[model samples]
Target chain A: MENVTKTLDAKGLGCPMPVVRTKKAIEELSAGEILEVVVTDRGSIADIPMWAKNTGHEYLELVEEGDVLKHYVRKGGKTTDKEETPVKTITNEEYLEIADKGPVTLIDVREPDEFAAGHAPGAKNIPLGQIDKRMDEIPEEGDVYIMCRSGGRAGMACDTLETFGRKNLIRVAPGMGDWNGPIE
Target chain B: MKVAIIASNGGLFDAYKVFNIATAAAATDGEVEIFFTFEGLNLIHKEGLKQLPMPEGKEHFAEGFANANVPSIEELVGMSQEMGVKFIACQMTMDVMGLKKEDFADGTEVGGAVTFLGYAKDADITLTF
Candidate 1:
């Protein structure tokens, strides 16, 4: 008989919940052992793999049973880890700080007229409508931060950068107008 | 580098949502853009961005810009350009708002839904603000 793998059901959760639970399960497991995670939240579908990559775990399988998503992951064998890395969640202040530093690209994803009125200091203008045809303008190096009037447009930019293999990407927590900071 | 943002709501909160998305995209090195339509045109109106009440529970901007560090409407529009975020005002909303090209910020442009649709059609991802 095949050995039973530890299963974690994290259905009906949102965003980081499923990923957090899976991380906990992987921590309790031994090397070569499998962890099966069942989740119903759609956000979990994207969060799991990202979590695994960030945590140095190997993702094995993903299966959908009925309405539930089942993911199988393997934990690393090393018990003594040298360094602990911080998770990559963008905050409003952090966004400003990064922008203040050089070698950063900041894009406004709003309409043209809106940009002319007010925006951040040193922010480049590229309405979301033109991003596809103007992909050449994007740089392959350095951190890229996406912003709009709200958080919605930034999410799209984050997903786009991730799809294009631009790993150093983050969405502003709030947005340019909503950010309680200085604007150009 | 393809970025697409959907602006469905018309309130100040909605405008802020789109602003955040564009700024974050720019930080990631992607040529970022935001498509404002329907109620989104309100975002361009100088008055619309200023003196608006903030969303509840948000201590910074919600308490009011005077008390908070939030940039004013004019300031946000200026910073958006500095950050490389392109702002596109919807033509339909412009007509509804009874506004003209001169009514918006310095570098504002007018666009219709077809323009935004064409741009977002093949985007890596499209998010509604």
Candidate 2:
């Protein structure tokens, strides 16, 4: 939470001006670093988020205390850089297309409950925590498509699988959050 | 607890009043729903909250809100949504006002008065604003 690298006191500023100033400050912000902007403008809560969305910044949140509003925005430019996994990856659409042609190995690294709730059809469930003991269940000779709720755990699973010298690992980027199709 | 709110006015304050109560009720782990009908449909228009301005003559209230840090109408609605408050857009009003289902916020249910009543029928508390 203390990741904020800079603070802009934008109090007493009126409409558009505060947001404009925020834009200026955001330009100077380093990628992935959070900027804590203190503003008195009530509209900033909505305006800041809108501006952030339009400008491609990550609107973390807004906190109101008494008569002051604090908006946290992170320079979204390189935020994905940190989350970029080293493993080979495919989108849900790509995975589906490949699966449609043949029996593809799709492993869901989400917890059992989440996998049970809804997941890609034919995807095997192996919780990220249990990947070690469940290594034998994972196919070693085929193109293994691993996924999770988002893409975080699947990346970790890729690292674990890599350690075992099982090189055919492809994580589903932005996983189930964007999964499109029928789920059993 | 189940909470139901009827928003009949379209003013900026109307949005604040409806969402304020809806969010407060929902904060307590209640199932809350706000029915937007008649003029209230203006509050749910895709860009309604942003388009709606402080009433004329109360324009100075903008400064006061700025000074007081009142959450914007959009913010309140967002908070209400995040707190699980359901928003229902009156389909009849939509047809009357030329508002298509896509004209309202995403996830806003397009329904008629009877549909809203169905949800409010068993509500523990129901209010009209």
Candidate 3:
């Protein structure tokens, strides 16, 4: 088998850094080529395999070379277009625009502790736990958007709404952590 | 488990990030809901989450969030809705922003603070993004 090999020196990079570098390196290679990724984060040890699967690259070998972790990935003959393509997310200006013209309902899915700390100026506190029973409370006229620390719980809230047949919903991308714009 | 997202940031970055998270959560058979507030309200604006700028030295905030396995506000909304996630927005913020019910993302809700808090109160895990 013909194989072209490249080395990625991502030893000190963080969680997504190594993955990004690895993806970039692979993008430059042809089928049957191998990319060797050296990373320092132990998280990569597990992330690499998932990346390979998610990206359609074949994960050949993963080894712990002392404190550094190494991964060997090969471009497969078949392309995996099922992989996700990165997209631009919501922004501060757009957020204002949407809110400016919405017959929508907004909920702050963060815990009571976090909500008390500080949140968007006029957001409601619908902690994730009580959403089910309180589903009736959410207005029936407009859409709903759920937000939490980062994007984790918001995603959860989005999912719940779908199950109850409450169509027209969204999550605050990047959640509260990324909201640098004006609050209340 | 049920899930919800708050897309408070106002650009494509948050829109897409929220979507990815919803997809992942829905894949696990979890119900999802997303509420937009503050700047997050912008995600519902017409084509609001499109072509957002990438921060200098940052490959676009949304891309970074995606590369990190995080969801964009819009994407979360779409994916969650596809897999059955509910979406919402803040009515107070809308009023303050001089917005109307018709201006938000097609399916977003305009709600209050207590509404979200009500949900967060009993969730297995609650987070603020």
Candidate 4:
């Protein structure tokens, strides 16, 4: 296609593969450059847009012909994990042990639907995307435990919060998705 | 994430769903293990794809997938294994189906419920289909 800088053929891949590959391909692109992802996975129709939105990229358009879909996305200046601060990490077992003792300011960084399904009691629902705006809701000074389905989103939240001057943040890796503790 | 999948159906669509999810999870940096039991073992059988049945009213799926070049269940199975998704066929199912370990593709593990539960225990996501 005209004006297409590069093409990634993720054809025949199912589910999240197209999106996962798109993330890597887009990173190799300079700001304002475009990456074309060709895939047969229909899920990418919705998944690609959501990924682009979450990663600060511009989803240009999707061209479809038969089973093939060509997705155009323009690279954003900064990455979703640009300010990555590899902070301290804790496991689900350790988090559970701490929670059993008393109250902990655990921030569940997953979406509302996931939170509503199951979450730690007394855990705040400040999703990773909304953390920047909801920073005030967190305690001005205290140890805050951040968690998500696994740990990726929580790590992102920690990075974003770190940029906002959060000092006492601990991440729960292998997060709620592996939690054997009580849920509210 | 560590993902544990229980595949208990042998239908074509069912096989596709399981393999699709498994391969996708593996591609997304998740460690995936699929435990095939009951009728699900048909998927790993050497001749299963040739005999795989289309679900009622969804027979067009085969034509559509073929026309679109979407990988078949067999292809998806290969892709899943290539992506490092562990494949475990049930020992009891093998006896019931009169199949031996050699009846499946190379590198498939044979295990029972205890093995599956051991892997599923620490899994972040457990799905049954």
Please provide, for model 2 over B12-93, each residue's C-alpha lDDT reduced to its tens digit, 9 standing for 90 to 100. Answer: 8787778766755554346898999998888878687686766778887767676755567777776667667899998888
Which is the leading candidate under lDDT?
4
Put down candidate 3 lDDT per residue, B1-129, tens digits, no spaces: 666567677645455566555554554445667777888776667555555555456664545555555334444445445556666778888888888878765666667888887776666544445
* Per-residue error (Å), model 2, residue A48: 27
lDDT of 1 by residue, B2-84 (tens): 68887766666676567655654543334666776766666766666564455566757555535423445555556566667
Per-residue CA lDDT of candidate 2, range A66-176, in tens?
999999988776342335546898787888888889888889998899899999888999998999889999888979999986566787788888888889999886678
* C-alpha lDDT of residue A15 in model 2: 53
* Residue B8, candidate 1: alpha-carbon lDDT: 65
TM-score, first chain, each model: 0.48, 0.58, 0.51, 0.57
Per-residue lDDT of candidate 3, residues A75-99 (tens digit): 7653312122122235444655788
Best by DockQ: 4
Steric clashes per prediction = 82, 0, 145, 0
- Candidate 1 regions off by >4 Å? A1-184, B55-61, B64-70
Model 4 per-residue lDDT tens digits across residues B15-77: 878987787666556799999898998888878855788888988777776765556677777
RMSD of 1: 19.4
Note the Cα lDDT for every prediction shown: 0.65, 0.79, 0.65, 0.82
Q: After superposition, how far is residue A118 of candidate 3 from its true place, in Å?
A: 60
The segments of candidate 2 whose C-alpha lies over 4 angstroms from its true place after superposition are A1-184
Share of true Cα-Cα contacts across chains kept by each model: 0.00, 0.00, 0.00, 0.14
User: Model 3, which residues run further than 4 Å from truth?
Assistant: A1-184, B59-76
Model 2, residue A54: displacement in angstroms? Answer: 39
The predicted structure with the larger TM-score, 3 or 4, is 4
